[model samples]
Target: MSNPKGKTYIVEHLDPELGQWSELEYVAIAKETQVAQGTFLLSSLPEAFNVPPALSQVPAFKPERRGVEELYANDKSRVCLLDPSASSDLGPDDGDKFDAFLFGGILGDDPPRDRTSELRKKGFEGRRLGPKQMTTDTAVRVTRMVVEDKIPLDEISYLDFPELKFNDHESTQMPFRYVKGQDGKPMMPEGMIQLIEKDADKSIDDLF
Candidate 1:
């Protein structure tokens, strides 16, 4: 597989309708989360969105108030337009080479007709996650899942993620997280330990 690495970018093509401001907020949060997890994020906000000064200045946030159509026009290669209406599934062949990901960053029961037409004109390959529509944040997470190459975790491995861990003593409301057992040693699952150890061997793999 061609490593996506730094080549993949998530584009948040903002909807022009003023009412979509709430949807744009959801897109922004998703973008921030992806950025934290090491993905590039771009926001193509129309002037109608009136992107506030605070959001525009955020680190790793790229704002293009111009129409998102121009982005595809400028660079068509490896740009995938995510459309639930599209027939293509984002499988290994399509996801590996894709450099840019475009999602209609609007949240609603129905997609904007004009937006779909505009993206279609740009000739970006359209792919759908499934028959059902998903929220902007969910789409972002899915994008990362496809683009990132990693070993799939088993049920036992899932237990080690910090979010899934719980304090052994329910009576003690610890002020901080304790990943170590009562013996004062790291208490992670064996699978998690193996995954951690593999990091040193895979350091040269460049998927990080």
Candidate 2:
């Protein structure tokens, strides 16, 4: 039972805007990840943007206006990027070796537009969770399962493209892979199902 307080987890926000989905994921990340020394930092922000008050507890930096190079400056070699296209799997032993883990703050597209390549192109050591795309929070939790809990990637189970049954006629299919909980259910963040239903209803409204 080791706490992941020793490592710093950063979400490099590349999304055009922070929406409810990203917000829910970040809330989960803030609750689960115990970063080292300071709070969770969402970097590469725009000058005009403000992190909602709910996430005010976490640090959001506009690197253009406020330099944030210090995050990985202390030791860049110890940092790893969770890239889906990476060559190797993130191992359990990697937890003690790395000080910082970087995750992309973009929505996982159904076909995967490779948005992480924005940071991947920057040349940080890259590691993969698997071949499939996972939601940002799922990626973070899976990374913690390896790094913090010392679990191997293959030992973990997953559910892919699970459809959320909003009602008898309305259901939404998630396009990302998710870690299967012991209950044999996709381990989704709180408020996700409701969000799915809301989005599903909105889509229906758009059809009218």
Candidate 3:
């Protein structure tokens, strides 16, 4: 995406376990190329729920090995390009900035029938529990472009991505707490929390 030095588009995923709060899964800022595209699972949740095997491995773009054009040739690939100057109409809703590109079936093996079945099975807890499915099974390819002036990363102070709310409110809010270090202080990397907070806010704006 093209923009002035200070602004950026923080790409993220709305955590299924944590409602309303969008997790800062990835970050995208302006770069010299002026063009950026990546492949992601379009129907991530459903795929995760139905066939967890497909969703086991984390998806990553090997642009250096394979060009974007060739990588996103099929319906399974979800691609998004961020442009700081373009309109914010790339996502599903008007405010939805993040784009859902391709819809893969899922990531890991199917969940066992019960706790005993789970113990007999193999895989981590996070992988065993399939991701929550979105409202629709169809996955839409998404793109987002914004102006540098509109988003200033430095201005962000807090960020959070809570689980989806099942009540009257659209979403629930959760604190982005940091782990305690040996010194008895919140053990977190410098500027990491701030960056997370900024990204969370950006995702929320897009969700609305």
Candidate 4:
């Protein structure tokens, strides 16, 4: 994919302890979803980007997963870490300074203490995306919006998101509604109920 500013890559630092089947599944989904969103999701492992044959059609779908730390070491000047506690925020014209944006893929509630300290010591400037923590995928998307649209970091507010206006007849609204009835019964659509049941069954099967 062509990143007008330069080649944009998202690096995911996988946790060694997160070797669960479901956790690995989430990693695969995250990688594929980012590829679908026109960004490459790279890893430190050589075999991490071995996507299925169907997804191999897109050049951006294939992630470069070899010696990511070395790449950062080679281009230490361009390294930036998306940490909320950082002193600096990325500016509009800041996209061109680096080819890749790195994000840690820790699903835990708190940031990876050791990795964050290491990145800081290596001269990777911590850049804040928002006041609150964000999911790894959300961080990647927000980074794209900043880099691609050249939006100033300070002007970008999560609380004041872009409003979507649609004509009454345009049918842009979703048909699904999830709520609770007066009797405390679930007021979900039939399709949603089926989906929930299916997922619950799948979870139970996976537990065995």
Candidate 5:
């Protein structure tokens, strides 16, 4: 797939703190050149804040004392918000309809906090991926397949709530949707298993 002409994928970083989770996802999101020029991070950070070297693939924009609304105010109609609560699913034809696609960069909450509503209320055209909540990385990949590869939503394969096993005795389940690969595995961001194991081990420590 080639780059979508003049389309930039925007992630409005809503999380208060930068963590391993967002960093890995942003890196994965940056790999799809056909769907985006770059993973543009929009956030309010201190004047001295610098994007981590790992995220060099993503371009960071200062808040400029402007909120997401003000920053995109002029192009509101040209932006598409990926909102889970949206009534419609994004499709291949949307490639030429919008200049940019905006996604919330908040870490997902189980049962979903619907944090995207913050962006949704901005009144950009909204589209849904499916009924399941997906990690930011998966969402970007799916969107790329849909818009740039001209794949229909139903034509895409998916793995839901995949389980991660640390050992024969223990495992944890991710309460999210993921893209399924031809090898029959969930397409996950690199280092995600380590992160999952780290969280799983911490849960054990909490019980002590």
Candidate 6:
């Protein structure tokens, strides 16, 4: 597909365990083209973009409680987008309006969750977590980006994922960038870019 009109913002959820490096999940395409020029539902982009639903929501193979755990533990993180024409819910001529890409990542145990209190008490406000903790932060960041039209770094609190023994003494911060596509191009909307850059600069100044 042709690139969208705005700057691309790539958001990744890195899993330190399983040797899975950073995976590109969500790509917010530019908003100027005829295909992306509307208030589309977050659920509608798979068809227009010729991508897959798996691109948005990764499926679980097992039905039991640990099915989720087993899936991720196996390191099968790829998702497939099915043909919309085959769905009874969608018509063949439907243009893939919301087929814009969406993605994320999962953090493995590293810095250790139990040590979070130590970090927080030591003036480390953002660091450490369980799966729920990390997911919550991710959801909040994505929502803020969509609603406020900008990415707020401060909104993201850090959690101690496991770190290498040699790098144990290093400090980790939550790093963020505009979402990008598989082609290494940004998929951010035009208006979103201005807001992200503006808010990011403000956040940096506040830190000082």
TM-score for each candidate, following the candidate numbering = 0.54, 0.83, 0.20, 0.56, 0.83, 0.18
Put down candidate 1 lDDT per residue, 111-207, tens digits, no spaces.
3233455566667788775544444444554555555542221111111112322335322111112223556543332343333344433321121
Which ten contiguous residues of candidate 5 have the minimum total lDDT?
57-66
Task: For residue 8, give model 6's deviation from the true position in Å.
Answer: 23
Per-residue lDDT of candidate 2, residues 1-208 (tens digit): 1124456667787654677777777777776664423235577777776676656664321122222344566667787888888899999988877767788656365566676777777668889998778888788888888987789998889999888887799877777899998888898878878877766746421211
Off by over 4 Å in 4: 1-6, 16-39, 46-58, 107-115, 154-208
RMSD of each: 13.7, 4.5, 17.9, 10.2, 4.2, 19.2
TM-score winner between candidates 5 and 6: 5
lDDT by residue for model 3 over 103-157, one digit each (tens)?
1111111221122222112211111101222111111111122221132222322
Instruction: Write candidate 5's Cα lDDT for 54-161 as tens digits.
Output: 666444322333455776777687778888878889988887786667777663556567677777777889988888888877887888788877899999999999
Q: Give the top-scoring candidate (lDDT).
A: 2
> What's the residue-level lDDT of 48 in candidate 3?
31
Better of 3 and 5 by lDDT: 5
Residue-level error in angstroms, candidate 4, position 139: 0.6
Q: Which candidate, 2 or 3, would have the higher TM-score against the true structure? A: 2
In angstroms, how far off is 123's CA in candidate 3?
A: 40
- Inter-residue clash pairs, candidate 1: none
User: Candidate 5, overall lDDT?
Assistant: 0.70
lDDT of 3: 0.25
**What's the lDDT for all of these models?**
0.47, 0.71, 0.25, 0.48, 0.70, 0.26
As a TM-score, model 5 comes out at 0.83
- Candidate 6 wrongly placed segments (more than 4 Å): 1-39, 42-183, 204-208
Cα distance off (Å), candidate 5, residue 204: 13
Local error of candidate 6 at residue 73 (angstroms)? 34
Model 3 stretches astray by more than 4 angstroms: 1-64, 73-79, 93-208
TM-score result, candidate 4: 0.56
Where is model 1 more than 4 Å wrong at Cα?
1-44, 110-115, 149-208
